[model samples]
Target: MAVDDSSTDPDGGSESESSASGPSRSPSDSVSAVARSVADPILEIRDTTVAFNMDRGESRVLDDVTLDIERKEIIGIVGESGSGKSMFASALLDAVVEPGVLTGDITYHPTPDESIDLLNLSKRELRDLRWEEISMVFQGAMSSWNPTMTIRGHFEETLDAHDADYVAGMERAHELLSDLYLDPERVLSSYPHELSGGMKQRALIALSMVLEPRVLVMDEPTAALDLLMQRSILKLLKEVQSKYEITMVFITHDLPLVAELADRLAVMYAFQFAEVGPTETILRDAAHPYTRSLLNATPNLDADVDEMKPIPGSSPDPVNAPVGCSYHPRCPLATEQCVEQDPPFFDAGPNHQTACFHWEEAAEEIPFSLPEQTDREASR
Candidate 1:
C-alpha cells in the first residue's frame, strides 16, 4: 500500500496523518519495501496534492496522490473528467500553469543516489528537465500546436529552446515521423489545420519525442478519433514503447483502452485514487466499490451492451468535498464508519491495493472471473 504524506485536506487536517498514528506499519516502510522490490523506478510521486486558488477560496484538485512508476512500463491513469488526472500529470513536470500550489514531494530518480526533487527545482532547472528527461503529449493537437507554425516550425522551436543542433533536430523529426508511419516531407510542410486529426496527433507525439525523453506523459492521446484511427494510434504507441523502452504515463477516461495497453491501472475518483493495482487484478477482481462500479459501467463488448450499469450521483465538489472516504456518498457498501473517517489504502493482494474499508465484503459482492492466463500474459 502507498502512503500519503505532507498533504492536507481543505479543512487543514493532514489526510494521512491519522493513518500514521495507527498500529499498522508506517507508510514509508511500505513504500521502501516496494521500492526495494522493483528493479528500477524512474519516478516516485509521494503524497502529491495540487490545489487551485479560486474566487471561492482554494479548491483541492488532487488529494494525496502517491505511486511508483517503473522504468519501462506503461501506467494508465483512468478517471472521469473532474477527477484530477490531468492535474496530476501536470504536477509531475511541475507544469501546473498558474494559481495552483502543489505540496508534498515528486522525486525523479534516474539512478539510485540521484533522486531529484522536481517540486523544489528552480525554473531554469525545470525547463531543462521538461523535454530532456520528461515530455508531455497534451490532449488535443489543436490546443497543443500553434496554428500559424508549421510542423517543422514547432520542431525548430522545441530544439532551439533546448539549444540543440538544427540539422540534427530536422533529422530526428523525419525519423520519428517515419516511425509513426507519417510522410516526413508532407507532415513537415503542413500547418496544424492542414493535417487530419489523427495526423496532427501523430505530429504532436513526434514533437514530444524529438528530445528522446525517457518518460512520456500523454493526456488523452487518442481522443476525438474514429475506431480505426484510435487503433492505429494505439498500435503506434505499443510499437514506440517496445522500441524506445521509455516509461509512459497514459491518462484517459477510457478504462478498457488502458487495460489493453497499460500493465497497471490507477482508478481515480473524487480527486483521489479509489484503487491502484495490476491491470489484470483490477479488471478481474476489483477490490474497491468505485473500481467495480467503473468496470460495471464500462461498455462490455463480450457481454450484452444493454446490461451496462451507470454509477449514481455526480462527483463531489473539490472545494467542499464530503468528509471521510469521498466515494462513501455513492458507494453501495458505505457504512457509518466509512462516512466518518477516511480509509487508508489497504493491501488486497500482491502489487494491488484499495482505499476501501470493506474491501473483502465488496470483493465478495462483485467477484469476476479472471481472463485466461495465456491471453493476459500475451497482452502484457
Candidate 2:
C-alpha cells in the first residue's frame, strides 16, 4: 500500500477524496456487500460505554459503541480530538483507570468456537490477555517510552512480565525491528531520547509486535511525524499486517492516512459512531451528514480554497450533550425530529449503517453545499 504523496496536502491538512468516480450506488447496496464479505469477526463490541465520575457530574466519553472487527482486517476508527477514539481503544484492552466506569460486552473470539468477554475477566485474566492476545501501540512514541530505559530493557521487561523465553523474544524483537527497516542492534542499545521521533515510533511498533499478538490496536501511530515519515510508517504497517495476518484497530483523525490503510472506516462523532462501512463506499458516498461534512471539510488538491468547508461549530460537550442527535446543531440536514428524538442506526447501504434520520436526504445532497434553513435556525 504505497501512499501517494499527492493524497495529502502540503499544509498537513486531513483527509482527501478519491479521484476516481463511478456510478452512484445506494447506501443500502453497500450494507449488503459488507454483510456478505465479513464472515469472520474477531471482536464483537456491543453497547460499549465509558463514563467518568467528574466533579461536575458523570461525563460520557464513549456512548454505546458497537462494531464487529473482522479477522485479519484493518479497521480505521476516525474522529475529532475529544470524540473518544483513544478511549475506545483503551477500553478494548480494559485499560480504563479509576473514576472511569466501563461497561459493555467486548467479546473476543480466540478461536471460532471459543469466545471471551474482556470486561468480565478478572484482573489476572485481563493481564494475561494483554500483549499476548491483544496489544496496543499507544499514541506519542516519545512519551510512551521511558527515557531512563534502553529499548532492549523495554523488550526484556515485557517478555519477563509475560514469562516468555528471553532469547526467543529478543530474536523476535530483532527480526521485527529489522523488518521495519531499523538497525536492530543500534535501536536495541539506544535509549528513548537517543533515537529520532520517527525512529522511536518504528521502535515502538516493533516492540508491540514482539509478542506477535492476534490483534493490534494502534492509536495515532504516525502522529507528529513528517509527511515522508508518515508515508513510510503507513507502508510499514500495511506490510506488518500482511506478514502477521493480524487484526488491526487503527485509531486516527487523519482520514486520508486511514483511507490508505484500512479496509473499512468507522466515523465517530460526539462519542458515538456516526457511520460504519467499507472504505470506498464511505469515501465515495457518505450517508450521515457528519460523515459527509468531514469529507467535505477535507482539503483537496484539485479543489479551490472556497471548496473546502470546515464543519460548523464544535463537538458537543459530552457532559451535557444535545437532547436528541448530538450532531443536530451542526448537521446541514438536521430537522426538528433530529433535535427532539435520538435517531437509531439506519441501513444506508450494504453492510453500511448510520445514525441519522435524514440519511436519504444527505445521500441526495451535494457535498460541501450550504446548510439548509432549518440547520441555520437550529444552530442559532
Q: Largest lDDT belongs to which candidate?
A: 1
Clashes of 1: 0
lDDT of 1: 0.77
TM-scores for all predictions: 0.88, 0.86
Question: What is the per-residue lDDT of model 1 for residues 277-341, given as tens digits with 9 covering 90 to 100?
Answer: 77887888888888888878887656576667788998877887789888888888989988898
Query: Which pairs of residues clash in candidate 1, taking residues 3 or more apart in a chain or in different chains?
Result: none
Q: Judge candidate 2 at residue 90 and give its lDDT.
A: 84
Q: Give the C-alpha miss distance for residue 301 in model 2, angstroms.
A: 2.5
Angstrom error at residue 107, model 2: 0.7
- Which tens-of-lDDT digit does each residue in 215-274 have in candidate 2? 999988888899889878888888889998999999999887788788889888877778
